[model samples]
Target: MYHTWMRYFTPSPAHHRLGLVCLGVGLQHGALPAVGPRVLDHHVAVVISAGRGWFRGADGRRRTVTAPALLWLTPGVTHHYAPDPDTGWDEAFVDFTGPATAAYADLGYLDADGPVVALTDTATARTAIGRIARAARQGNPFLEVETAAAVHELLVALRRVRADTGADGHPVLQALARDAFQPLSVIEHAARHGMTPAELRTAVRRGAGCSPKDYLLGIRLGRAKELLVGTELPVAAIARRVGYDDPAYFSRLFARRVGTAPVHFREQQCRSVPGGFTDRIPDPSRPPTIPPSAPADDGRRGGG
Candidate 1:
C-alpha cells in the first residue's frame, strides 16, 4: 500500500522578503498519478528518490525522470509528469514562490528551461526537503519562519552542488579579470569572448553575482585603492594609469564609490602609518630585486 503526507501554507508578508516562501510540502510513495499538461502559477520542485517516471514541459519536450533527480516546474509553464505504475516511485516535493526565485534563475542556480536536472548530491537535497516536511507537519506558530529558513538552506545546498560540479562560466570570469582596466564597452568585452552582451551579462552575473560593468569597475577601484596607498603618484597620473582619461571625472567617481577623494584617500592612508607619506610611498627609482610580496601593484584604467 502507498502512503502520502502533505501540508500547505498561506505565507505572511514577511515571508515573501525572505526570498522563499513554502506553499506546500509533501512525501509520497506509490505509483504516482499523472499530473497536468496544465499550467501552474507558482514554482514546484519534485524529487524522485527511487524508481523512474516521465515529465513533459510546455515546449512539448518529454524527459525521463529517474532516481535522485529534480524535476523543476516553473511558474506559468505547462508541465505534466508521472511515475511508472510498475515501479512506484518514492517522491518528495516542495512548492515555493518569492522574489529571489527570479534572481536565482538568472544566476543559473535554478534551471527554468530544462525541467529535469540530475542532482549531484541527492542525500543533501533529501535532507533539506525532509526538514521542510517535518517542520510543516509540526503545526508550530512559526511555521512560516521555519519553512522559509529551510527553503533558504535548500537553495544553498543546490548552489553548493552547482559550484562543486563546475557549472559556472569560468571563461567569462577570466576575460573580465584580464580586461578590467580597459575602457571596453560591455558589448566589446562580450565580443572578445564570442558571446552577446546579454549572454555575457548573464554569465558574469551568475558567476560573480554582479553585472559585468560593475565587476569591471570593482577591479579598477581595487587597483586605485592600492595605488593610492602605495605610491605618491599624482591623482591625475593615478587616474590615467587605471584607465580614466579625465582626472575630474575619475575624482568624482572615486569619491562616490570609495567615499573619499583620491588625494584624501592617500592622505588618510599615510596618516595611519608611523613615519607619514615618505614611509608609505615606495621609491620607483630603485626597483627592488624582489618585489614586495605583501603589496600588489595594478596599472589599468577605464575610460570617461
Candidate 2:
C-alpha cells in the first residue's frame, strides 16, 4: 500500500549487518490528489517541489507554496497540504532520523519548524537523494554515515544559495564568508584576502556598506548568539571561545551590540525559549581576544 511519512527502524538483522542504517530517504509525489492530513514519527520532509498550494504550516501560519520549496517538519507536527486539483506538483523528499538531525538543526539547516529555503537546484539535491536511496536499498553497512554526509552536503548547498547574499563580490568578504562567525579582525581577514588593512577597509565600505571591523563584529555577535542559545557553556567560557577574553568587556560589547547584558541576554533567551549568559572577567593574560596575527597585504580588493 502507498504510504505517506512511513516510519520504520532497520530490523535487528539489518541493524547488525548495517552498523548504522538508522537513517533513510524516500522520494514521494502525487498527481493532483488532495494531500491528506498526516503526521510523521521519524521523518523530516523537505519539499523539493510544489505548485501554488494553500496550507497551514506546523507553525500554524497559513502560507502558499508557488514554486519548489523546502519544508522541514519535525516529528509529530501535523502538516496539511493540498495541491490544485487540476495542476499537480512534483516533489522529491527524503526521510531521515538519527543524532545528526539535531546537528542539522544546530547548524540552522533543520529547525523546530519551517524549511531552510524555498528553492534549490534539483540536480544537486538528487545527488543526495540518490546516495541515500542506494545505500538504503543495498543495505550498506555505512548507510547512516554515507547518508549523513550527503545530508550535510545538501544543507551546505542550501545554505550557500539561500544565505543573506551580502558576501558576494568583495574578495575579502567573500573569502571570509565561509566562517563569518569566527571573529577575525579586519586587518587579519584582509591579509588573508591579500589586501592591506587600509585597502580592506575601503573595499568593505564600497561593497558591504560597512567597515571591515563592523562586519567582523556582526559575525562574532552572530556566533555569540548561537552559542548563547544552543550551548550550556558558561558566559565567560563562551566569551573566550568566541574570541573575547574579558567577560565583563564581552558582556558590554554584546550589550552594546545586542542591547542587553550577557546574563540578562541569556535569561531573555531562555524566556524566549519557544523561539529563537554572563561571567567573571578573567585576568587578561595578554587580553583574551582574537588578535590579528597575520601580516598586512599591499594589494587592493579589485587589483589583480
Candidate 3:
C-alpha cells in the first residue's frame, strides 16, 4: 500500500499579491493510486524523484514518467498519471497560483506545453520542498509568507537542475553575458559562437527567456548605469564604454528603456549609493547563481 503526508492552506487575499501562493504540498511514495483524466484550475508541480510512472496529457498520448522528472499540471489543462505498482515512486508536489505565473511561463521558467520536464538531479529541489513542508507546520504564524517565499526558491532550484543546464548552469548564457559589452550586431555575435542567428536566438530564449538583442542590451545598459554613478565618466565616454560610440543614440535608447536620461539617472542615484562607489565593480557577466567569493570591497572610489 502507498503512504503519504500532506498539508493544505488558504491564504488571505492580501497574500495572493505576493505573486506565488502555495495552496498545498505533499510527499508520497509506495504503490500509489491513479490520478485524474480531469483538469485543474491552478498550477501544480509534481516532482517525481524516484521510481517510474506514466502520464497522459490533453494531447491524448501517454508517456512514461521517470525519476527526476517534473510534471506540470497547469491551469485549465487535463492530466492523468499513476505510478508503477511494483516499482512505486517517490514524489514531492506543490500547488501554486498567482497572476505572476503567466510572467514566469513567458520567461521560460514554467511551460505546460511540454508537461513533463526531465531533471538532472532532484537533491536541491527536494531540499526546497522540505523547507516548504516545515514552513507549512500548523500555527507557524508566519506560514503564509514563509511558504510562499519557499515556493519561489523551489522554482529556481528546479530551473537549476533541468537536464539542459548540466552542472555549470547555462554555458552559452554565461558566454553571451561575458561578451555582451563588445560592439557587435546580433548576427556578428552569433558568428563568434559558430551559430546562426536563429540558433543563437533559440539558445538565448531557452536559457534566458529573452531575445539575444534584449539580453545584450540588458547587460550593456546595466554596466552603463554602474559607470555613470560610480565614476565621473562623461555620458559620451560611458556610451562608448557600454558598446555604443554615439552618445546621442545611447541617451535615446537609455531613456526609452530606463525612463530617464543617463546623466539625470546618475545625478539622482549617485549620492544614494550607500558607501558610495568602489574602486572596481564586480564583473556583471557572471550569472546570479554564482556568488562572489572575492574579498570584501576595499572601499575605495574610482580607478585612481
Candidate 4:
C-alpha cells in the first residue's frame, strides 16, 4: 500500500509575472502506482529520496531510477515512471511553469537532455520541497506566492545537488563572479586566471552554459540593477561602479539587454524599502540589501 497527499493552485496572471508559479506539490511513498506515458504542459521535479524506480523518456530508454535521483518532466516532453511495487520510492514533487525556466535551462540548471539526474544527496532538495509543502497547507493565505517562491528555491536546490554540479558550482564560476565587476576584458580576465581565452570560454560554457564575457556581464548587470533600485546613485555613477567607464555606452547596453533604460527601470522598480537602508555600500562580509517589497525579484532577472 502507498500514501499520497497533494495541493494544486491556479495563480493569477499577476502572480505569474513573478516568473515562476507552482502548480502543484506532492509526497508519495510505499508501493505507489505508476505515472504517465504522457506529455505534460508544464515542468515537474520528481525527487526520489528513497527506494527505487524506473523511467523512460522520449528516447524510450528504460533507465533505472535509484534513491537520491531527480526526474525532470519538462514541458511538452513525453515521460513515464513508476516506483517498484514491492518497495516503492519516497518521492516529493513540485510542478512549475514560467518564463524563467527558459533562462534556467540556458544556464544548464534544467537538463532535458538528461532527464534522470543522479543526486549527490536529497537533503537540500527535500528541504526546498518541504518549503513548498508547508506553503501548500490547507487554508494557507499565502499559498500562491509562498509556494511559487519555494519552487524557485527548489530548482536551485536541485541544480546544486545534482551529482554533476560538484559542491554547488564550478570554482571558475565563483572566481568569475568574484571578479565580475573588475574592469577587465575577457582576455584579460582569462590571463589573470592563468588560462587562454578559449580555455576560459570552455570552462564558463561547461559550468554556466555561457561564454566568459556573458557570465561577467550577467554579474555586472545584476549588480547594476541592484544599484538602480536599492540606491540613489546616478546612472553614470552606477555605470562606473559596475565597470563601465562610459555612461552612455552603459545606458545603451542596459536598455538594449534589459528592454528598458536604466532610469526607466529604476522608475518602475524603485520602492521605499521598510528599513530605509538604501545605500548599497559594499561590505565583503554582508549581502547587499535589495528591498523585500519586491519579493519576486531574486536579483538574477535580466542578467543572463
Best by lDDT: 3
Which window of ten consecutive residues has the lowest lDDT sum in model 1? Answer: 271-280
Predict model 2's lDDT versus the native. Answer: 0.61
TM-scores of the models, in the given order? Answer: 0.63, 0.48, 0.86, 0.70
Best candidate (score: TM-score): 3
Tell me the tens digit of each residue's lDDT in model 1 across 163-274: 3244334667876888877767899999998999999987887776788888887888888887788766788887887778888998999899889998888888773433
Better of 2 and 4 by TM-score: 4
The alpha-carbon RMSD values of the candidates against the true structure, listed in the order shown, are 12.7, 17.3, 7.5, 11.1
> lDDT of each model, Cα atoms only?
0.80, 0.61, 0.89, 0.88
What lDDT tens digits, residue by residue, belong to model 3 across residues 66-121?
99899999899899999999999999999999888888887788988889999998
Q: If ranked by lDDT, best first, what sequence of candidates would result?
A: 3, 4, 1, 2
Q: What TM-score, to 2 decimals, does candidate 1 have? A: 0.63
Q: Tens-digit lDDT track for model 4 on 1-304?
A: 9899988889999889999999998998899888989999999999999999899999999999998999999999999999988888999999999999998898888889999999989998889889888887678888888988888888888888888667748888888888888788999988988999999998888788898978888889998998888788899999999999999999998998899999999999858554544445678888666566745777776864
What's model 4's overall lDDT?
Answer: 0.88
Clashing pairs in 3: none
Worst 10-residue lDDT window for candidate 4 reads: 272-281
lDDT of predicted model 3: 0.89
Error in Å for residue 69 of model 2: 1.3
Clashes per candidate, residues 3 or more apart or on different chains: 4, 0, 0, 0
Across 157-247, the per-residue lDDT of candidate 2 in tens digits comes to: 5544442333134456676656554546666777777889998877766555677767777777777887778677799988887777778
